[model samples]
Target chain A: MNFDMILAAAARLDGHARHTPLLSSPFLDQIAGRRVLIKPECLQHTGSFKFRGAWSAISALAPEVRDCGVIAFSSGNHAQGVALAAKAHGIPSVIVMPADAPALKIENTRALGAEVVLYDRATQDRDEIGESLAVERGLTLIKPFDNPFVIAGQGTIGLEIAADAADLGVTQAELLVCCGGGGLTSGIALACATRAPGLRVRPVEPEGFDDVARSLISGKIETNAALSGNICDAIITPHPGEITFPIMKSRCGPGLTVSEDQALQAMAQAFLRLKIVAEPGGAVALAAALYRGDALEGDTVIAVVSGGNVDPAMFTRALATL
Target chain B: MNFDMILAAAARLDGHARHTPLLSSPFLDQIAGRRVLIKPECLQHTGSFKFRGAWSAISALAPEVRDCGVIAFSSGNHAQGVALAAKAHGIPSVIVMPADAPALKIENTRALGAEVVLYDRATQDRDEIGESLAVERGLTLIKPFDNPFVIAGQGTIGLEIAADAADLGVTQAELLVCCGGGGLTSGIALACATRAPGLRVRPVEPEGFDDVARSLISGKIETNAALSGNICDAIITPHPGEITFPIMKSRCGPGLTVSEDQALQAMAQAFLRLKIVAEPGGAVALAAALYRGDALEGDTVIAVVSGGNVDPAMFTRALATL
Candidate 1:
């Protein structure tokens, strides 16, 4: 609701979150017929931007409650982010994850010293499980999105993007972001609105899991039929978050969607061009930027590679697709 | 020779070169029994630190001579770095390369709009070919590592490392670098000497091509028996540069070498842990840091993943090693 909250989050995450580099490639520029700046959050702490929101939410909690514990539900990135942040604060944490989530993600969350509670995406509800754990254990719930502090924390990236763009002498550019519950999108949109007014922020989603794109069009929140099948497991939230949708509706341009093949192709391109690993979900914004070239404006465009916590098998498959 | 020159290069490369992140992993810390800070230059422009030296050398030439053109001899990374920097400066550039170098390197260099002249590594003399071309075309020669401007340019990374380490509260750390002609090693060593006094810089090489390592011990330059067989083609210089070796000898602790298998394993480990692509040559320093645990001192260790211009087949092979 307040842009000041995003600024507050930026101050809080100063020494904690990485001010990830804004990378460009002549090869990618030629492909899109324009300059493209890549914000590689794939290199962020915990291998994703989720750490920003996780830290923001947990750090804002009352000390006694935080000391008690925190509960979260994520397919992977968010779970690890919360686990690591909690550990940093010396607080007990538990994460509810899909049993089918990337093996690397599950292993990483556990490695961060978080208790893992697995549930079946086919028949069980992760939120219900997380909620029950929170209630039973008297733990604070840090929802992946739909939280003010979490949204504000993620908005810090927008501030960096705006500042970096201005530093590069780019006054205006098309900004593409990987979207799930619209938390990252809305947060970034808010920052761009105040800091880099010339940027046109847009949300990008996987083809079948484009609830946010549909919601943006209808001017209301929408839900996906199912959440289990996409290779982009990280951004397959069922719908846009309540707190995030209003902000996105006010600030974002039309959302875009990319096919599974396109996402895999983008992942491969990122490896070849950016020399950074991008998980399926993380590559969607790049996929949109590459495939939806017609929609881009100005000579410069920016895309965020949001996460890189990919399983070896999945990465191998993405590489083979190239 | 002067640290002030490196400071000038940092200024020149301010907006041009990426101020790459200093990444840390607890997993790697547990393995090495020390905290490891990864400088992912793989995310750098041209996918390597070579751009720094290339720009430094080319940009220092007189305007008329620079406008006339430039020529250089390199296996891969330097070629691309020179090509890209030349393109940025709107100057013509020619690169003489080993015909057996990675195909991806050749393709990328050519794609950057450089004229690539391939020479047989076993029979043909690349330097002679480059010299002849430079004389014929009135092109200025930009020696990859031996040039003072180039060394100063590469040294900019040292300034960044020191600043970043200080930000992380790491006053002292063991710095490991992949060495070829020792341009990068000497450059960083110079920066550390003036900027981060507590850092102990060391050069790393492939087992068969430990010319720099051997030279450090003998107090004179040494040459590798063969340059055509190593998987780390980028860092397979016959000997350390005259300008680089003396500086390295004066500042560096000692040189280290890793076997081919160790390099490959390190490449895979980088993929798994850092989620970044590191070429075999680029992964050598990381190999030393991860495996040569006994050699490391202090709680914090910094290793440079210098380049990521690797052929797909080679990367596939490296991944398979995991």
Candidate 2:
């Protein structure tokens, strides 16, 4: 919610979250026609940036509340992140996930000591089930993006990007973030607004799931017609969060959207040039940087690869693009 | 070749080289049945730790010599590293590569402004061509592993591991390194000997290409029966380095070898759990950590993923294992 809170969250995440590398390649630079630097949060705990928010929210809770247990609803990445963070603190966690989510996510969450409750995405409401379960078990609900602590936690990434940009002698650049519910985008926008004012934040999403991009231009929260069918399953949200929309409206630049094909291509490029595996959702921002260069400005562009919890079949499909 | 030179290499690489991350995963720990820590040098520049040695060898040269250029011969990773390092210094570079090497590496080497000369691995002598080219062009020859400066450069990784281990409260562990001509293993072994005395470095290689392992047991340099045909082309050297073997024999622990299947499985595990790409050669150490655990020790084990310039087809095959 604020810079001090972000700094506080950064302190709580110390030793728990990975300080991921800011990577670059000449091949990537040539393709983007600019200096492209990447902050790969896929290397974060639980293979996503969600762990930062999960840790920030869970750690800030009172001992009694946290001990009572925590619960969250996620398609995949956030489920594993919260599961791992709760397991680390020796607390019980309940995760409500869509039944069709990647099998790896379901198994990993359970492996991390979480009770995974799967529900039909088309027929059942995950939030309703999660809330009822939380009430019955005295579990604290940790939302993916709307929560202040979660935003502050994700904001820590902006702090890192700002520091790295300055270290690399980059005072100005467009910081592109993969947008789902806009938690990551808003948090980073807030951080850069204060720390590296010269750097602008932009949200990127899959073509049909470009609610954030639409919302930014309309100056109001916009909703997507469909969410579940996209290849970028990790970032397909119905709409931007209430808390996140205003931050993007005020502090972020116009949003960008990339096709599923571009996302797949970006994943292959990431594999070949950067030696990093990026899930489709995680590759969207990079996709924009690489394929949508005509609309972008700046001598240097920083893109955040937000997650890498992709299934192998999908990964192989992405690799096929190469 | 020594700790001081490694320290000096680190100094020169302070801003130039990526201070690659030391990653860990509960999934990897569960598989290895021990606390598994990964130093993913695959995330290093040019998709391998070879860049460290290349930069070290090139940067330490006198200004006049460095300005003229550098030359190196390799299967792939070292060629790219040397090419990129030379390009960064605005110096011309000549890379002699195997005619059958990965097409990606050959194209990348040429793309990085290096004149790549392809030679037949079965008949042509690479050293003679490299030496002749260096002599004719007034270029300093940067051997992949045999040179003292190159060893010192690769040893910088050991210094990093020592510092990271100390920070994480790990004083003693088996540091598994993917062995090529023993450059990385020896460099890390020598660094750990002085900096983190409790940590023991072990060389890991693919089966049939385990010359470093056999040489360590015999207390003398040993040669592999075959020179090519392995999928792990990046690390299939004929023999241990003349300079590196003595240091590895003196300072490192007993060597370990893993089957190609295990390497492929480890590559999948790295993709699934660690979210980093690992070439089969790079995955051998990780393979040893996971499948060859019976031969390892310590409460914690560190595996260095040495390179990740894998072809898409091979990467797809690795993913199929998941």
Candidate 3:
């Protein structure tokens, strides 16, 4: 958890990563009972924050490794991120996606000039296929999470938040970020600890998949039933990665969880009040803030709106539920 | 039109306007056969470019008039814009909206702290109601388009585009802007005429509402049976306003028309490629550039994405169609 490495990674990605707008909403501030700021990573290239880590990881590879290309297994955003990053580096990459993945994401991965291989999640193993492909082709497997470079890349967001908070006259505050495999939270916590040491970094997760929160409380890795039927397909059902859970537990602030309904409400609020389209996963952090009203009291909060690549159909359905 | 007045309005809105990001899309560029620069006004306050005009119009009022408050009739965005602008000035306001207006928009307008008066568009005259409301309350009526202040306010976007274009090394280009009552096109054309004379300013209309183009050719106001089933509820059906027609005729480049299918495709492309949510009307100009390839040849072209307030249902339907 060296902050200098994160800063160095930020320097390497100076022009590559978008300095996404830090959007402020007077309406959200009024509702949240505190000053609130939103970091819109949904507007990032490839429509997610994953691009930062993917680009950083791809760019950091040795010339020979880069030439040999890369492989990764992801259901959505990370697939697009890796695909686009590999294309940018002139590396031929193959992404193994679940057969049930959204068609738009599959098309986007292909559109970014990457090879897509679909694997049945129920009948076949995605990781095994990815590993075999990487090994056979002498290609590097870029893990979506659990990679130090990936963590450093995601930390760039924390750097931006720290600088932006300072500019907004915010000295200390709580930072809420959605958690999947804990990469985003772990990376962001590391950066916040280094840049704004007093700032609290909280990982917000879906109620059904609160493994990270449970793990944090027990001081050990925990598993939860693989949750389904959650509208936020992006972060609803993932277990914390082995490498990321420890870092997240050691460096991150208290973990929180919110129901699916709360996430829907937050997503709707974002659409109606902020006039920005945020995917369900993107709204989870805000959901936690809205749900944990008393917990967030007296704290100026920043919510990481992690991505905005929601399918139009899913977005409308989520809004209807709200 | 007085360029000085427009420039003054621009100056007044210097920091007030969002100075929305002019996003370049390599994906769209590859598809459209030309570089595409999108001015994302959908991300503007009130979810439309109407915010600029509304704010400018409200801000330009004399202190006495400001004290009196403001009134307006709109089906959607303009209502919210006036409501928000009046709130910013600490003036009470009333918005007269059709009874059948979108529920989200009506609620949003009221939430912005405006008094919303519902009227029957089929049986009663909205303008008459608005005028009476204004007269009875001593409130100023902020016309949706047909006003000098409003046009100048909308012109600020053109100023922003000019500055952005200079940074991108783009000069002498086609500027395609969506046209409803022609306020945005007239204002943008006037601004470009003064600021970048070589720029060709084209007003794009829905296939069903080519009134501005027809009027420009005939040298007189013309009316047509409003088309049915336009996806862009905000602008697809409005006839050109009297004040805007002359300016549009004199300053605008050749007006262009795009089909409903084309508009939906454009919206889809914007969401998929640029990761921005654009309402149908907001994407009409971009649709013209993308679908009317032969018509928009030459130097770099910019399309004004007028707004991003599509109903979630409409967006889903549009995406499904695409």
Candidate 4:
């Protein structure tokens, strides 16, 4: 991946996506024993970094393709991101959500002027359905992680973080991000590598779906059958995407795995201490930072709180468990 | 009261207190039938607008007075605010909290390095204890609302909103601020009246705590009996303070009240649409805008979400009730 492409995407999205604040927490600093910065993507439009990718991808489409609109298969943040971005570009968007996806996400996507299509994950393949719709309607398909425009779009977060870190007198630091399809981790790694060459990028995954870590260990693509075990719904992917895997392999540092309990604890901590509600998936990087003390030791680390589109029921249950 | 004083406070708190973002919500705008800007003090340090006041007040204290320490009485945001502000300034601070205060608030105040002295609200006089502590320890009493410094500090939020609104092409707007002891509402009113004279400042109160509104109508400090009710804990004030009443009466335009149900509904809406966790008290102004439709017509409005420190149990219960 060329850094220039990501920089061009950032330039195109200059005033579109929010330059989300690089929030500093003295409490987090005390815990890490080093300066800690939080890139609050939870504050981003559609409550995730997915908006960056969706906007970049949709905006870069040809006029004819844009006229035909776009289709995406996501059950959470990416769904809302595409819905909102497509609306902003005056394009029709259809989001294929799992039958049991959070009601808030479904409602929010529809509210953002997207057509909501529900599918039972156990009985039907969402990707096949999305592709069929795309072909039948002559619409563009915006993959959540595999698209280059998406990666370049999410890379803008890293640019913001690098600029902020420099402003805060932090030239070098450890950056922790949650890995699912690896879009955010890879994008952030590429940006950090080019902008702050000395910065170390660590990608963390939940224990049950540690494909990225396993793939790194085995030096190839890895797969897992247990996609929806104890891991949070947003990060419970079976494997990394083909497009994202190469970026993760080349740019990301060693990957780490955190337990479900740790992620829940981190979610509670974010809510209680930071007074911000971070969905379970969004809190994984923070969980790794807090529980994986040895890995983060003596490093000025940045934890990407990727999103906050948590279901109220799930939030209450997590709070109870915590 | 001076524009320069507010500007100076803003400058002093440039990095000390969060320059909390003015979040725009199309969902809120559609529901309220006007452009809605949310000043998320829920994202502020110590989880409330109290942080701004406490930080500004403490930062401007004479060096000798700061060294002598400070005392405050509260079982809510102010207690945490004073504790954190004092800790930030390296000054010893004492807080008088009710014995049955939320465990989170008590823990947070102690965590911020304040000495917590528990008092029984039903049987003991908190003011007596606070005054005694101030006299015995030779500490300055940092009154939560009945202080000019605190009001001036709180005014900085208004200054920020005015500047942000102007940048957003808003010349005049209705500012809905939740009224507790009226420190925040009064401060905002003063700042808006001075800086953005065309701005309309509206104070919102919970149904049972309409002292500010009543005082506005009666043209005097109207006292209300301390009645037990199903109101949010943070803004369940019995009456407005002496210092804040006059400013609110003179500068504030009108006051409105919403039912507990409305507050709960608004809180849920904030969670679902804005993706921000807003405690019932913090959601009151937005509740007024959402429910008091005819009262807030034909104007762009800014609602100040003053805090987000609700106990997890209370938050769940509030949502369940809704």
Clash tally, candidates in order: 0, 0, 1, 0
Better of 3 and 4 by lDDT: 4
For candidate 3 chain A, the 10 contiguous residues with the lowest summed lDDT are A269-278
* Superior candidate under lDDT, 2 versus 3: 2
Q: Which pairs clash (backbone N, Cα, C closer than 3 Å) in model 1?
A: none
TM-scores of the models, in the order given: 0.96, 0.98, 0.87, 0.93
Candidate 2 chain B has its poorest 10 consecutive residues by lDDT at B100-109
Prediction RMSDs, each to the true structure? 1.8, 1.5, 3.6, 2.6
Local accuracy of candidate 2 as per-residue lDDT tens digits, A1-322: 6789999999999998989889999999999999999999999998999999999999999999999999998758888889999999999999988898777668888998899999997999877898899989899999999999999999999999999889999989989999999999999999998999999899999998889989988988889999668899889998999998898899997899999999999999999999998999999999999999998997889999999878888888988888
Q: List the residue pairs that clash in candidate 4.
A: none
Q: Could you tell me the interface RMSD of model 4? A: 1.9
lDDT (C-alpha, whole model) for all candidates? 0.89, 0.91, 0.82, 0.83
List the candidate 1 regions with Cα displacement exceeding 4 Å. Answer: A98-104, A119-129, B98-104, B119-125
On residues A1-322, what C-alpha lDDT tens digit does candidate 1 reach at each position?
Answer: 6789999999888899899989889888888788888998988888899999999998888898889999987757888889989998999999888888767678888999899889998999877887788889899989888999999999999999999889999869999999988889999999999999999999999888889889888988889998879899889988999899999898997888898998998888899889998999999999888877887777788999999977767787888886
Chain A superposition TM-score per model? 0.95, 0.97, 0.95, 0.94
Q: What is the lDDT of residue A60 in candidate 1?
A: 87
Comparison by TM-score, 1 against 4, better one:
1
Off by over 4 Å in 4: A24-36, A97-105, A117-129, B100-104, B120-125
Worst 10 residues of 3 chain B by lDDT: B229-238
lDDT for A33 (candidate 2): 98
